[model samples]
Target: MSKEFEIAREFEVDATPEQVWDAVTSGTGGWLWPMEAPEPRVGGKGPFGSEVTAWEPPHRYTNRVEDVEGISEQTLNQLDYTIEPRDEGRRAWVRYVHSGIFVDDWDNQYDAAGRHTDFYLHTLRQYLTRFAGRPVTAFATFEGPEASSAAGAFTAVARALGLADDTAEGARVRAEGPEGKPLDAVVDYRDPYFIGLRTDDALIRFFGRGHWGHPVGVSVHDFAPGADAAADEAAWKGWLNGVFSQP
Candidate 1:
């Protein structure tokens, strides 16, 4: 049997394939995924210094990757992105396939691939959804002696969600802790906030500080016309709960 494994993930974004393609081709766009950078042209730089093997505009892009940094001889790998139009907007599918020898175990590689796929798709969805019609925004609040730490945490979270470098407008942190302080940070579409710190540990603390108001508030536009705030909240809560449930 071939020692190759493949992992794929799909996401629905409220934008046209061209828009999604633009995001995928943008400098900040590639950062949302595992690839270091993506050059649109064939034979151009791809993930991990690989070369683009295929380029089909607004639809599919494929690259040939290699492992040229060790005892392992150069091997061939492939990463592909396919976009399809959907009723709401566009559906994007990213597929990764690896072939060749494996010194250790392939299980870890598979696990990592799965994680990366999930994170990338989630980030893409979040970015395209938030920036679908309006400019991107970053909302943050800080507390405790580690205000910078909190701000850093928020930034890290934003980044993981596909926000770019200039998206943030610095930290609007408060002087006191959660109980006695309030802070806010907002960023535009051209400059989106990308979270860079450890946020999983401070989830409850962050929410308790009343900073979830804007970030978690889903727009009514995402739902049907008759949908109310309660329904929106419930849907968002479910989505968030599902995300947190992931290992």
Candidate 2:
């Protein structure tokens, strides 16, 4: 019989409970860097047809998928979040629990979920630390060959973007990527762990720690009005897929 899986995590952020609450609630799309819930109240609509099941200001929130298009059948999928004041009310303590049923490929699915949870939480921390309250949009894509090493994945993305894998912060950069899209960016942040590029239209980032310690991923935080997010996502996806397929 197919079984179910649950993943839970906790994270501490240098932001207040109210700040974290806004990010979890309606203010996420702006800085949390993904599709956001337009309305975060009970009976309100959210991303991917998710509806708010529980809502408490600056304390707790829960959402569940119901009749959402593009959702895969799994038997169960729910996200519960709890936020509290910590560090003498100077920081936020958060809990995330995601539980769902998987009819097949339980191992890979669970691993990916856990790692992605980590990555997204890291992104949230970065946002709260440096870019909170700034307008932003996010697009992410994953690439495969589960055998690929973290360093190798980082190299591929760096080469594809015409930048050094170990680029230093504050370096002037001009590169062209797949689909002949031109990128005139500055190397803003770089480390053995992550890379960030600042461009005219967006802040781009690539993570070497692909989900589950394999596959590589890139996320673009676009700020332009009327930007075609779907097309941009497709372009990057195709580019990364092609890069990984190369011998």
Off by over 4 Å in 1: 29-37, 68-71, 88-103, 132-247
Worst 10 residues of 2 by lDDT: 66-75
- Candidate maximizing lDDT: 2
Candidate 2: C-alpha lDDT:
0.69
List residue ranges in candidate 2 displaced over 4 A: 31-40, 66-74, 137-154, 161-203, 207-217, 223-247
Global lDDT of model 1: 0.43
Considering every candidate listed, which one attains the maximal TM-score? 2
At residue 169, what lDDT does model 1 achieve? 34
Question: RMSD per prediction, one decimal?
Answer: 14.6, 5.3
lDDT against the true structure, per candidate, is: 0.43, 0.69
TM-score per model over all chains: 0.48, 0.67
Residues 183-229, candidate 1, lDDT per residue (tens digit)?
Answer: 23222121222222111111111221113212321122221234344
